[model samples]
Structure formats: structure tokens, C-alpha cells
Target chain A: MSATRVTTPVQSVDAQAEWELAYRSSKLRDCEFTTLSGTPLKPLYGPDDAPIDPARDLGLPGAFPYTRGVHPTMYRGRLWTMRQFAGFGSAKQTNERFKFLLEHGQTGLSTAFDFPTLMGYDSDHEYARGEVGQVGVAISSLEDMQTLFDGIPLGEVSTSMTINGPAPILLAFYIACGERQGVSPKDLRGTVQNDILKEYQAQHAWLVPVEPALRMITDVMGHCAKHVPQWNTISISGYHIREAGSTAAQELAFTLANGMEYVRRGQAAGLDVDQFGPRLSFFFDSHLDFFEEVAKFRAARRIWARKMRDVFGAKDPRSWMLRFHTQTAGVSLTAQQPENNIVRTAFEALAAVLGGTQSLHTNSMDETLALPTEKAVKIALRTQQVIAEEIEVAHVADPLAGSYFVEAQTNRLEQEAETYFKEIEKRGGVVAATEAGWIQREIHRSAVQYQRALEQGTKRVVGVNCYQEDEGKGPQIEILRIDPNVEREQHARLTALKKRRDAAKAKKALDDVRDACSGKDNLLERFIAAAHADCTLGEIADVLRERFGKYKEPRIL
Target chain B: MNDQKIRVLVAKPGLDGHDRGAKTVASVLRDHGMEVIYTGLHQTPEMIAEAAQQEDVDVVGLSILSGAHMSLFPRVRDELVKRGLGDVLLIGGGIIPGDDVTKLESQGFAKLFGPGTNTEEIAKYVIAEMARRRAATGGRR
Candidate 1:
């Protein structure tokens, strides 16, 4: 009676609109569509559909809140630098591949160190067996580093080393090697996968415990800021996280959270945000969900910009910028119908380009079987080139920016990721969470769910669960064959290098590294000095192991 | 199939950080009612062999993606024999080539599995092989 007496036109209009929409709906196969993160999607999008504040959320490319890209021109000015993850056998062999990739138009160098090198052991060390130059080129000392980049100019080409626990020593080796090549650390431009937190969460290449690892990372940050200003002390990576079976949102959120933690450590170490943040970079995995991957990248830029500005109080625009390298997901590739991997890679690469990655590494078709052959590697490189040249997808910035679905999904994903970040913080940071097995358990639970879905044919992987042919049967794809003798040859080279080096000098250099590790001294500085003394990687590794000791992971399962 | 559990030792022999596959395989094998002893990250050949001997594992499953498979597998094979564990089936997995697999098998490593190898098949093989080995050993355990 009261409503009838005072009924407003607004109330009647609202009721009429609701009734019209409720009656107008027609039956379809499925009424609702959504992203994995539970973001609602409409059937279409237009210029008027986006809910973004242009100046606040997504400014111009290269501006604050760089949702479009970190650079104004982006790929229009230069296509992403194609860097293939290449290494195996000896430094001589990997060095050859380096030249090959460069000659074939690889703009950056990404080094994959063997187990022993990564673990800080020499080729002759008992633990070094089977691993020397098997997974990557073994660089045990300055001699190996020198051989690794022998013909390649360190002064010009930016190099990224996928080493963590011993990243400081490796950086020192590179600096010393650079000195030998008449290059200085100041002029070098590259990254050290010096992200130790992710090491605990995703990759298990950690040498020391979390506390020392954080210190080592900060040491690089301080040293690189002062000396190697052009170098990125750490490449905050989500590649391994995704490869370890994380969803896209987890990868984005966890990686940025790790990046924030690193920044906090750097600040605590007395380094200014502006001093080190400009050099901070990221490495992401471009998964099979093309649009999702693209949305993830755009959302990453928006989230990082907001965090750097509001949370960390970053002043410089460069401090807020997120320049990242994208690598197509290796876990996505199937060993069945190996050639189909090429198509998957192409699509992934296209997503990366559209996502505005600063650089890219497309997974080779044969990598699921073995380290890629030169021909297969070339196809991967060509995949990027074709996307940049032939495909006109990069003409516009955030081409899908205003698309209602993408914009809404991006927001939803960013929100989900933020929730995860809060959860990680509540669990006492990523390292603590990992130590407590919370992070591992979460990943394990998700992995189990995904596998169960696959098993039950709920998730359709084109060639896998459904439409499986012969179920793991196929004509074997051509695998990149490595010579078994490479290990023997690497051993001989290590022996010869040891025989020729000044034993006293090498011993002293290693002693310095051990002293540094035992004390609060910068390990990178001593490592550089050791490299000058021509100490082998194994010698340096042994010294550090004696002082810092190897990490023993707490078993979750 | 009320058989004795298959004791499988899952080992990472090198510094390569990729272990999802290894962990997944271990979990799957355990789900299939096998006892899996995972020697945590960065294990050497000596450690792997010692673990196998201590655990009295029926199978030693080595996962190496860091391309150190050739050096790692052969040395593990040698160590197993050195430790009088020649009875244990030394299997290999992860990014290994066909030709190298042949060479490794010739050198007495058990069968090689690649990227797409089924978790079920791995579990079944380990269970069946362990049963056979137990029969030969007169079921002392």
C-alpha cells in the first residue's frame, strides 16, 4: 500500500527492464561462458564494452600502468628477441650452437648450465658424473666460462643464465670472463635467473637455505646496481612455476609476489627502488590457452604497475614497467604427434606477441623427446619470425583491450591472483610457504585435479585424453641425438684445464670464495677474483658447498 | 591381485630442476599400491645406489632432463653392480634420445621411457617386474 502510494517511475522502469530481459532470453546449448578463473563472459564485445579507466588502468603503451606494453613502439619498432634455450655436451659444443643461433638471427643468448655447473661442482667431482654437459654446457670455472663465450662478444650480446643457487658465482665468472674479453660488467646487458624464492617453489636448484639465498640475491642486486648497471640482477620467473603445473593466475600472482619480496629484500639491503627496479625483468610461460595467456600478460602489467606505485612507492615510471620474456610452455608439448608441437608453439608464440612480450623463446618441436636438433630449433625461431613478419596481429596495442570478455577476464584473473598473493603472505611469504609445504601441496592438489580430469576425459587435450590414437603409439619423431662421447670429451677438457691452470692461484681463488660464503662478504666479488685465477667451476662449487652446504628439501609426499 | 607391494626408488641424479614428472610418476605408482622412496632433489649416483640398497628397492627409476642422462644412467648402472645391486632393474626417463636409450640399455640399464610414457604402464611394469624378481629371490622379504 505504501509502495502504491509513493511508487517512483525509476522502480517501475527497473521492473519493466528486468521483465523484458527475462522474457527475451532464448534457449542455447549453453547459457553461460566463463574463464578458468570464473570470470563471466558475454557473447560479444565492442568499443563501448570495456570497464577500464583509460588513464588510470591502461595508459599509453610505455606510460604508467603499461597494460598495453612497456615500450611505445613495442614490436613495431623491433620484434621480440628470439632466444632459444640451447646447451648440451661441452662448452665448445654449446658455443657452436650459440654461434649458430646468433647467425640465424637470435638477438639474445640464453645459457643452460649442466647439473654439475649449476650445483657448483667440477666435471671430475663424483656428483658431476652423467651430468657434465648432459643437461647443459658444464661451466665449472673461469676456463669453462671463457670457452662458453669464446667467440661471442660479451660486450654486445645480452646473456641470460638459468642458474639460481650458484648464480652469484656464475655472474662473477661471467664478469671475470668479460674482463678477459676486454668487457666490463658495467657494459653487460643480460639477466641471471637469480630468483631463489621460485627455486624453492618451482625449480629445485637451490644450494643454500632461504636466508642465505635471499642475501646472495641482494648482493647481486647491490653489486649490479653499482657495477653492472645495465645488467638485470634477477629475472623474476613464472616459467618454471607454470611448467611445474600451475594455473595461469597462480603463475602471474606468485611470480609478482616473489618479485615484490625480492624488492623488499633489496630495500632492506639499502638499495633504492629506482636504483634496481629498472633492471628488474620477468620471464613468463605462454601456455596453450592463447587468449588466456594474452590476458594474463596484460593483467600482469596492470597488477605490477599498481603494486610498484601504491605498495612499494616507486617514483620512476621505469620502476613500474614490467618488461618480460615469454617462453612457450614445454609441459604443453606432447610426445605423441610430435609435429603437432610446432603448431602449438606457433599459436603460443602468436599469443606472446599479442601479449607484448619483450623477448621470446619458442619450444622446439623435438624438445619433448630430446634437446632440439639444429633444424628443429630453426623452426622454433622461424615461428617467432613468421608471427612478427607475416602475421599482422601486432599492428595494434592491446588489440583485445576493449573486448568485454578479455577485459572482464583480465580483471577477474588479477583479482584471483591478488587473493592468492594475500594467502601466500598470510602463510608467511613464498619461501616459508614452500618450506611449510603449503605451496607444494597447493600445486600438488591442482596437479592431481588436472590429471584426474584428463584421466576421466573431462578436460579434452586434442590428441591426449579424447581421440587418443593407439594411446601413446606413434611413429617416433626425430630426436636430437647427442654423442655419449661428449661426456668423455668434457671430462678430458676439464682434466686438461686443471693441468694447465696455476694450481696455487686456483686454490687461493677458491679459498676466497669459501671465506666469502662463510662470512658476510659478497660472493660475487670473490667469484670474479677466482675466475681471474682460472679456478674451475668444480673447485669454486666445492669451496661454497663446504661453507654453505647443499639444501635438503623437506619431503612433502 | 593381493601381491606384495613393489618397492620403487625415484631418484633425480643431476641438477636439473624439473621434477613434476618424477613426482607425478611416484604418486601414480603409489596410488597403484607401490612403495615409492623418493630420494629428494640433487642426488648423486652413489647416493641413489646407497638408497636403493638400503631400501632394497626392486626398481631404480632415474629421471634426468638436464641432458646428463648418458653420463648419469651408465654410472648408476655401474654403481648398482658395484654395490651388488645388479638384481635391481635400473630404469631411465626424461628427455633421453632413442639411440642413447639403446646404448644405455645395452650397458644393462633397464628399459627407457620418454615424455609421454603412461603412469599406469610404469606402475604395472614395476609391479610385474618386482613380482618376478621376488619369485626368483624365493620371497625372502
Candidate 2:
């Protein structure tokens, strides 16, 4: 809704006056011209908007600051990993889906655990009714984990597990699964979404309170730095934070703040930043704002690189690189006229690549209604493949580098994030602010702002708010329905596993885990040993809950 | 018409933590001049029912994103009936399919809003429904 003509039309020259007269007389549609996050944009931009110094702000890719990208060649060297997160039903069913993805040319594996497992509950736990395999694969034991990666090679394929609250337990099961495949932890490459601060602030999944969760993360960091060298111990995520309704700037600010807290924790535990820093990665949501999303990624890199090198005093270049994964915004998809989501996802995927992500996941068309069907998943994957193979935009690094609008947006987001960092520091760090409900309140405020705009018709979402469409016009799309029997079958597996396991050994190892939670010992060793002793995820999490107590969120608006 | 302010309890009745929609609707209903009570995450059916009874709310809205509504909504509904609050409007939302929306609407659900639903619409629906129910019951408490 902003006008860009600064000079008076009457006093301006002939061309300017004529154009201004035409613009004033023409009927412009009533809509707000802004980014997806409500950032106002002018009709046109000039040199005055962006004054970027290339050498200092954005050095050559892989050089100091690393603003442009992490690598010198970028996609010229390798395309971003087309990692569609696929998990539903039991482990065997999810395994078939994984293999099907691999056969269809997916680059990496991204496993999504069901909500029960995400909350550290077994399939048969009382809290897990009707939710065993609804959203993702229901994994309860090492047997389930083993079946998940049955034929997939642990040595070759890199897998990323989206688990946070019980990250150490899941990683232990994964490590033991690899061991059975004759692959030591040294060769296993993947990422575990071990970030817990966002869980407290947004996602609402947690195994323990703030203090114990940070301890578990640092414990996993220490172990993975030595044995699981290739493993990304923590994917400091902004994805869920955004999904929970945050602006792009809040997403970057809160994500990197939590990341800084992790660095502080590792340093407090006497671990070097360079030791665990390179293994630390990030995950973000690519919303519908093309230039703004690209700028956010660039700003994320520059901020993290400067913090790692200057603030943390890490000398390794690897530690300075801020590698990240990106997923198209699930909140952007609509249930009405769902086919339009394919185009939305394609554009968002293009933004991720232009933003220089190491991996990307595109949300399926029908995901607004259910977990994507096979055809929907294929279309989502093909969107990425089309971007990788057919699109020539990736041949250059940070292709939007010098664009006036893009650079200006990048600087704007960076400054806003810095302001937030100071505010977070004023309230303490990420964990303390989260505990005080400051971060949650801030994110929810922006979410409500966006929703208000959408309702007011200022921000138009095609097929949702603006375009008129009848439901009977188009053919009904098939939706994926997880069989209700999956829960029954999962409960049966858990029952059989409990009967088959060595009860005494599991009890003793789980007791060790409980003791380890209280002591100064690293919890991962106990977790791995417990995994070997056939302990279920629920058993170990139950012990941790007993030792660490639980977290109660302070109510906020 | 009775000048009673519509009382509403927004409940997240399952393990999922997606409270954006719940909180947004709660805020919008509050804006529309309704008394609102929000039950935070991880509340069982009995807890929701007790909260509704204690608060004396006219409507109980359940928000669950984990696809547990078939089991959860009925359990909460039965618990409300057990507590003798069966007539309270029981509405909900999540990633529910169109078929499930029809099925649940037929099976004692007031209404089920899905993704992309405007919070204002939810508020208007509650106000109108409460007025209609009160008029039908001859304005009895």
C-alpha cells in the first residue's frame, strides 16, 4: 500500500510527470504490497536502498563471513539433497517407503517419528492411543529401529532423524542398528534433530525440564564428536518454530540464539567449539516470500560465521560454516483446491536452493488434509528434481547477491535479528527466555498478526481468501489414511518385545541410565548400552523422567 | 434474548503441542466479548470435562493435531455427558479430512474447522450457536 514517488509529480520532468499522472489516474487494486511476514515493500528500489560492500559483507563463497554460501562451487559442485521426509505406519511400512524413495532418486533419508515416539512414549503407552502411526513411523525399540533401516546401508546413505526430546535414545538405537550392519559409529553420517529449546518455545514436545534437556544435548554433543564423528549431533531448527507461527526474523533470531546457547553449553562442559561445531547444522522453513527467504538464509550464514569465528574463538573453518537444511512451509498449504500447493511448493523449493541450503524437503499438495499419499509424495519429490535438473539458476553461487531489493532485505533481517539478540540477552539467553515464555509470546504475536492480515484481505492466499472456487468443480483427490489397525499391530509388537527381552538385563541397564542422569557421566554411553540390552524408548525416558522430573509450561497468551 | 455472556473453554486434549489455532481462536473469541478458559497441552478427557464443569462454560472446543479425534472427541464428549454437561456445544479442529468432518459432524460434533479457517468465523459460529441453543431451551441455565 506504499507509494514510491518521492518527488512531486507537478514539479518533476516531463517523463516522470507523465508516468506519475498515469499512475495516479489508473485504478490500482486494493491490496497490501508486503512480504509474507508483513514487511512493507516499495514499488521500486534503487542504489540508495542497498549499499553492500562485497569484500567485507559477502566475501567469495567459502571465505570470511561466508555470506554468499558455504562452498566455493555451490550447486555446480553438488545439488542440494532432495530429502523428502517420509514416515508413516509401522517401521516395516516406513522402510518400504524409504526404499521406494531411494529407488525414485531421493538423495538422503529423512525419518519422521510418530508423535508418541516424538514425546518419548512407546506405542503401548497409555498416552499413545489412536496416535501410534498416524503422522510418522512408530518406533518403540531397537528392533523397530533395526527394521526401519533393514536393507539400507548405514555406511553409504546419510539419514536425518527428526527427533528431539529423546534424541540420545533414538541416536543410540540408530547407532546399535548400524552396529548390527557391521558399520561402526565412525562411518555413520546423518543428523539428529536434538534441538530442545524450540520444543519448549513452540513445538511442545519434551522429555524433561529445561536444565536436564540441555544436559542431554551436551552429552550427545560430547559423544558424537568422538565416536559418531560424521553425525550432526544437533540440527538447531527454526523450522518448527516457524511452523508454530513465527515471522522470518523471529525464526532466524531464536534459532541462532539457541545455537549460541549450545555453543556456550559445549564450552562450559570443556568441549572445544571446533570439536562439535562443524557437526552442528540448522533447519529452516522456506515461506512464500522469495527474496525475503533468500535474504534470511544469507543473513543466517553471515551471523553464524561471525559468531563462531569471533565470539566463540573457533579457528577451524569448518566450524565457521553454517550449513543448513530447508523445508517448504507446511502452514502455507491449503485444504481447498489443494492442487495449487504444488506450484507453491515449487516456488518455495526454488527459494531454498537460491538460499544455498544443503538439503531440502518439499511439502506435498495434500499434506494439509493428511500425511501425503504416494502420488502426492512423488509430485513433491519431482518438484525438487525439476529444480535440480531443469532449472539453471543453481549454476551460480548466491545468484541474487547484488540485486538491490534482495541485499536490502538481507541487511534489514540481519539488523532485526541483532536487535532481537539484544532483547534475548536482556531477558537472559534462549533457554531462560523460553522458560519465561518470552519467546513463545513473541512468536505467537507475529502469528496472530499474519492471521489478522490474511483475514482482512490484505494478504491474499489464492484458493483460500481471494479466488472463488466451488468444491464440486474438480475431481476429488485421494487422501492417505493410516490404517487404525496400525496402532493395534504396533501395540502387539511392543508386547512381544517386552516378553522376549531379557528382563533383568534391561532393568539393570535402565537403572544405570537413571543413575547416569543424576551423575556427571555422559548419558549416551548408558543409552547405547541400554539399547543393546533391549530397552525400549519408553523405559529409558521413564527413568530420565524420574531422575530429572518434568517440565510445566508457564501459561501465556 | 438473555444477556448472558457466552462462556467457552478451549482445550488441547491430546499429546500434540500445536496450540496456534487453539490460542488464536481463544483470542478472537475473547475479542468478540466471550469469557474464555484455555486448557494448556496434555489434558485428558476427564480433566477437560472437569474444567468445563468448574468453569461452567457453555461450549467446549477440543484442538488436536495428532489425528486422535475419533477416540479423543468421543471420550471428551462422554466425559462431559457423565458429568451431566452433555448439552454443551462440543466443537473441534485439526488436520481432519472431509470424510471425517462429515462423519464427526453426524456423530454429535457441533462443527469441525480445518486448516486455513478464519478465527473470526469460529467466534461468530460459537456466538450464534449459543444464542440458538439458549432460545431453544427457553433461556434456562
Candidate 3:
């Protein structure tokens, strides 16, 4: 050891100097806080930051351990579908919006059924009253389905229906409508949000108990796996979980737990993972945290991949690839300074894109105020376009690849989510947690925390809390106001459709649904047959509810 | 004067299904001493009123956000009058339009609060309004 002690020139720069140069005039920055799930984020990250195995964790895209992106050339080959979720009033009105969106260069379609249809009420039913078409399209029967897809070629467009509980009935009607259009069930390419676990956890839209609801979900999964192989049977959604004020990590943990439960149910039904798992997809909410949302998606992909491969023994790569659809977080939209929502949406949309989403729906600026108007919706869609075409974001895959902050966050999120997964498993998985209201309590705790933060000004929402303007508030953004007359029109259509359909045939089909639901027979097949016979959604639901009995949530506060 | 019971109808108007706040509010209100009639989830305005009338409530609270509250709340207000229950105070909450708050109030909405509103204020408002209504109606007959 020659004690050379050669004094080398000061290496490059000190940490503070580098930070100042990198972040621009940063004082000795304050200590950064950990994520909600206690994931520490360093003030910086670099190539050697992530504690991930190169061969095991950072696998190539379209291969095992997909970290770069899901597909080889995600946007270079084809952009994610720009599916604007539009529906209100009646099927006729929603059909018009669908046609309009298509004419405006929208690729895929998403239908938002109203509460009545979601809860399985026909428009003519007494429970429907003011809710028939307030939130989304009203589908009382197969006739409404026909009208919804009228003029819009169902064979050409892939439609995603955001309905659960009654998802099977709606899917049945969709298949029947497609049959009338000269299309076979095997040719249909679309998705049904048949995930009921999230409903129990975050949304509370359960129409039946856990066992029966799972039965209905398995029915859809088995039917789609066998018949409509091109369709995604379920979209395990974390969007509502996040929207319900859950942290990004909670959304990931809870959603994956729900997805795993569904997979277990599907496997219990004797479907091979390779056969049914490929059709399993996900839906997520891209929130305001740019890097956090991106990391959430990456962490989600890794989690799902590992679970499918190691836990579920899914051999097929396609089964491991967690294909997901993302929507900008609606809760992140601000009612104050609404235009700021446009910027927020742009960043959220970018996060989704960079997160390797297969499909995305950006919320319009005015969504916080009302249903997005046509102008605002166009702008929202254009936000995605500008990012894809103008911003050159689509050119590179995982643009934030190897970034210090993102990598650390990704690792942290993965760890936190793994812990949550274990806890859920210990709690007897999703069903047990939901039944015991554990998941719900967790969501409530997180929501209360987030709300308290907003109330206490710990988190600054630009126009909502900070920078409050008293007079001459920002430009009044035009909100989409659904015409009230549409209700009367839909009611009239319901009356006419009820009068015109074959009463005896409808009654018989409903009887079949009831009989199938009451027994162990696959309700999907029976529901499909009933849909062909023009049995309205309400009629079918009435029969199922009469047998299944609705879920009365235990008082859990 | 005797303490008047604060009547509240927690409802979900649109397709959004997060009812933790609604249920939590109902429980807290009950604990804070209010007669809360939770309409459960996915309740339309008609169901809300049917519950309101059947329960003989004094105030109706609407929790909606799926961007349908603008059209949905007005319809609820009109139906409340149609059922001859217009005296019931209509309060709107959840993610509502700020400008539309005045519009809804002008259309006979008593109060409007978005997220982050103090639950105590809500409870106190309901109690005070019920007391005022009882006084106005000459001790609820």
C-alpha cells in the first residue's frame, strides 16, 4: 500500500451543489416526507437507487417482469384507445353521443348506465323515477340496447360497459343486440366491469350477498372465457377506490386483492389460468401526483405479474401481463378555478400514458361542475392527442425510466402493496375483509385522513383552498347540462317499448332468469336467452332480486 | 321550547357508489342526536321522498356527484313539492358546482356544502333549521 494519499481534484461536485444545479437554486432542502404507506422517498435517486434484481425485476417489455412497458412499442405501434365515457338520459341519447364521439375520431366506446340500470331497475319501474337517465344512459330492455348501439356498428367498435351487479344482464342484452346486428358472440370485443369486490369495498353497489355476487361474476367470467374469448370478462377497478379518497398504495393493494379473489373464484370454477386469466383486465385512477401515479401503475404491473406467475401458477405470459384501462381521477378535479382542471387532467393523462396504460379516458375540465360539455370533452380528448402527437411523449417508452425519484417510489410502492396483499391474504382474502368491513374501514380511515389534510391545508389544491379569489372568479367554464326533457322522452319510450313487446314471451324469459338464478345453472346462458326474448333489464332484475334478495349492508361506521 | 329533532335524508343520486361519508355522517348525526333516515345506496329522489314522508322528516340532504346533481337535484326539489312535502328543507352536499350552489339555493335549496365542510356545521345547521321550522309552523301542530 503505497501511502500515496494523492489528493484528487474535488470529484464533480458536492450533493448540495449538484442539487442546486439540478433543481435550480435549492437551499439545503428540508427533509422529504414518506408516502402514506410509509415508503421513504429520497430527495434524489439515480441508476443504482432501485433495489430491484436486473434479471428478476427489470425484465424487458412484452416479457416476464415487464417494467419498461407492457407492449414492445406501446404507442409507436398503436396508441391506447381514447374511450370517452359518455351516456345520459336514454339509449337514444347515449347512442347519439357515441356516434358523435366516433365522428370526432374516438377509437373505443364506453357506456355509463344510470343508477336504475346499474341497480337492475327497468325505466318503467317505480324505483326508477328521477334516476332513469340522470347519470348515464337508461337501458330498460333489449330494445334500449338496440337503440344504444343503433347506427353505431357494434362489430366495429369495442364498447366497455361500466356496470356491475346487473353486468351479466347488460352483457346478455349486448350479445343479443349484437346477434340482431348479424354478429356472433365470439366476434364481440369489449369489456364488462364485472368486478363486484371493489363495489363492496369502495362503491357499495352490491345487489346480492358476497357468495351470490361471486357466483354472478364467475358466470360472466366462465361464459366470456368460453364464448366471447375476445372480450375482457372483468375490469378489476381501483379507480373508485382512489376516488373514494384512498391513497395510491391502498388503491393498488385493494384492487389487486380484489382481482386475486376473482381469479380464485374463476379457478374454483375449474377454468385454467391460461384460459381465463388472459381476459382479466384492470381499471385505475390516475391522480394528481404525477410520479406517484406512474409508480403506482408500475408497481401494479409488477405485483400482478408476480402474483399470477408465482401465486396463481399462471404459465402464459399473456395471463401475467396486467392490461389496464385508466381514467383521470375525477376527485382530483377542482370546482374552483375549473380551468386548472385542464392542466391537472393533462398531467394525469400523461401519467397514465407513461404508466403503460392500454386505454385512457381523460376527464374534461368542467367535469367537476357538470357532465363535460362537448367543447370541454373535445379539449379533454385533445389533451390526450396533444400528449400523443404534439408533446412527443409517445415516442419514448416509460420516459421516466431509471429516474431516481420514480425508481425509489416504485420500489417503495411495491413493498407497501406487498405488505397490504399479505395482510389481505391473512384476513382471508377480499371476501372476508369485505364481509368484516375491514377493507371499508381502511378506505374510510384513508379518506378521513385525506379530507383532514385538505381541511387543514396540508395538501394544497390550487384554486380550492389556496389562492382564493373573492370577486371576479376565474372564467365561468361551460358545463354540460343534460336536457331534462330527455327524461320525459325516455319515459315515453319505456312506455311504448313495454306496450309493444310480447308480454307472454317477456314474462317467460324473466321466469327463466329467476329459475336459473334460484338454481345452480349458469345464469349467463339463461339471461342471454331471456335478452333475446326482449325481456327488459328491470324484469330480469326483478326476478333475480326476488330470488337472490338485495344486499343490506351491515351498519359499519 | 322543546328540542326539535333534526331530520336528514342521506342519499346517493348518481352512479358513484362511495357511501362511507353518507353512512358515517348518518351515524355521527345520530350520535350527535339527530333523527337520520339513511335511504341506503342508489336512491332516486322518489325513494328519498317516500322515505322522507314515511319517516315524517324535516330536512332532506342529497349527496350526489357523478356530475348529475345539477339536473338531478332540481328534479328532486320539484318532486318533493309534487308530493306535497315542500316544507322539508332541501340541502345539497358532495361534489357540487360552486356557482350552481346559489342556483340550487334559489330554487329552494336551503344549504349547499362541498367536500371538506365541517360535519359539526352541518349538524348545527340542521338543528337550528329544525328549531326555526318548528317555531314557524307553530310547534309542528
Worst 10 residues of 3 chain A by lDDT: A1-10
Each candidate: RMSD: 5.1, 3.5, 5.2
Candidate 2 at residue A76, lDDT? 91
Cα-based lDDT at residue A433, candidate 1: 84
**Candidate 3 residues A1-557, lDDT tens each?**
22211123333558657765877555654433545333555666554455556556657777777777789887899999999898887788788888888888899999988877887877666655656676788887788899999987778889999998889999999999999999988899999998888887777665777788899888888888889889999999999988876889999989998998888888998878898999999999998888898999988888899999999999999999999999998888777767888999999999999999999999988765667778888899888889878988887777776666787778778888889988988998778888888887787777766665665666667776789665352247665566677667777877887788888987887787778876878999999989888777877777777787877665455
Candidate lDDT values, in order: 0.81, 0.91, 0.80
Q: lDDT value for candidate 3?
A: 0.80
lDDT of 3 at A231: 94
Model 3 stretches with alpha carbons more than 4 Å out: A1-40, A46-49, A471-475, B1-16, B20-40, B43-60, B66-90, B95-108, B115-141
Q: DockQ ranking from best to worst?
A: 2, 1, 3
Report the number of backbone clashes for model 2. 0
Model 1: residues with Cα > 4 Å off, grouped in runs: A1-50, A466-477, B1-6, B56-60, B74-92, B100-112, B124-141
- Using lDDT as the yardstick, the better of models 2 and 3 is 2
Score residue A240 of candidate 1 by CA lDDT: 88
Can you write out model 1's per-residue Cα lDDT over A1-557, one digit (the tens) per residue?
A: 11121112233668756866875695555323544322455655433344567677668889888988888987778778888888887888899999999999899999988777776777777776666666678787777788889988899999999998889889988998899899877889899899988888888777777887888889888888889999988899999888887788888988998999999998998889999999999999998877789989999999999999899999999999998999998988887777888999999988898889988999998877777889899999999888877878867777877556677667667888999999998988877887887777677666665665556545556666545576333346666655667667767877887789889988887777777876878777877888888777667766766666666687767
Q: Which model is ahead, 2 or 3, in terms of DockQ?
A: 2
- Model 2 bad stretches (over 4 Å): A1-27, A472-475
Model 3 native-contact share: 0.30
Q: List-wise, what DockQ does each model earn?
A: 0.55, 0.63, 0.31
Docking class of 2: medium
Error (Å) of candidate 1 at residue A279 is: 0.8
